[model samples]
Target: MVKVKNLTDKEYLYGHKACPGCGLGTIGRLALKILGERTIVALPASCMSTVTTQYPQMNYSVPSLTMAFAGTGAVLTGMSAGLKAQGITDVHVLGLAGDGGTADIGLQALSGAVERGDDFIYICYDNEAYMNTGVQRSSLTPIGANTTNSPSGTASYGEKKPKKNLFEIMIAHRIPYAATASSAYPYDFMNKMEKAKSIRGPRFIHIMCPCPTGWGFASDLTVEIGKLAVETGMWYLAEYENGKVRMNVISKTLKPVEEYLIKQRRFRHLTEDTIKLIREHRDSEWRIIRERWVLSKC
Candidate 1:
């Protein structure tokens, strides 16, 4: 069993409007704990925005600003600049967005921010699809998974293309730091956030947050599913620094992808050939990662 650090005093308050076993809320709490009170979060039009702040009541202890769905990156850039002008170097500026907000609508702004070497942390809590908009298929949705927009039937299999490799895309920008995290591994997530806090230039962390409602899993199995994803090699945890990549220790050993896919109802309709295809793709990706890891050592 993985040991997670106990954070009994929740930075994300107990009474939020998130669904049961929602990994996004857990991610918010863990991130807030690491970021502390001296942090400003720029939230996009994601579930995090609605659940944390509704009408007059807000659950967050730290300052948060909501922006347009496609403007979180720009907002963070502005916040970072403003703080720098005021000589307020201690406070961390963070941008939080969902997969759709990050990978699709907000991609341009994000690319611009990273290209300019903005001093801020950008986090994308990817639940694999547009969960906030009724489980529509987004660019980040994995192939053969059933979302509302990518339903499987006799004529069509789920998402036709594989999930977008956002981490690789960020790495191509040659930013100071980039990492892939999972909500199941709170220690790893917190550690990465703490490290990003100390870094100077553009840093990005993509966290895989399993959604119980969207993924058609037991409400209580969010963390379990997240762990299985990493264990089964469906999700790879790694960090990129100074043009080098290193896979996390926990993700070095992996189980079969079937173990992970079988649990989620989204992948239930996948045919044997489709499963094999996914496995092949996963192995190929791992090989590329391994190559990168080896090159990082030299």
Candidate 2:
């Protein structure tokens, strides 16, 4: 078991609007804690923006900038440049966005920033779909997940496509650091964020945050669901550095996918065939990841 230190006195403050058991809030807290007070957070239009910056009071202890849904990466690049011009080399720039903002609408700006090799860290807290926008389906929504847009009725299955290979996308950009993280493993998440802070180029962390309202799970199952995701190999914990890939020790041994699927109501109405399809997809992806790990050893 990985013992994570308590960060109750960190950057995240009390009195926020996030739903009970929302992992996005946990992600924000842990990430900010690791990035430290000198960090400037850039949030695109997402759940974090709404909950963290409610009128009259803000939950974030550090400075935060709210931007358009597709402007996070671009704005962060500018912020980093501005800080550099002002001779503020010690401050870190952190960009926070949802799956919709990062994988879909914000992909262009993010790509541009990464291609330019901006000095900042972009963290995408993916709750699977556009949870902040009525639980709509986003490209990152996993196959067989029943979102409002991808309803699993007799006429059609849930999401037709598999979750976007976001990690690979980031790696393809040749960023200095890229990793997968989850609120279930706070220590690993914090360690990755801290590592990204130490690096001087563009870094990316894709966090699989669980949403109680969107996934139709009990509000308290956020952490449990996140754990199940890692245990089942649905969400792997891995990092890419210096042209090599390394899987986290805990995620090497995976449990059955069913154990993770059955816990979320989004997959409750899935047919046996759909479950098999999901398993096949998960296994195939795992195989590819294993192959990459092997290559990294060469």
Residue 84 Cα positional deviation in candidate 2, in Å, after optimal superposition: 1.0
TM-score of each: 0.94, 0.94
Model 1 residue runs over 4 Å out of place are 1-14, 251-253, 295-298
> What does the lDDT come to for candidate 1?
0.87
Candidate 2 worst ten-residue window by lDDT: 1-10
Task: Tell me the whole-model lDDT of each prediction, alpha carbons only.
Answer: 0.87, 0.87
RMSD of each: 2.8, 2.5
Off by over 4 Å in 2: 1-8, 249-253, 294-298
TM-score for candidate 1, residues paired by index: 0.94
The sequence of per-residue lDDT tens digits that candidate 2 reaches over residues 176-230 is 9999999888888888987888899899999999999999889978889998988
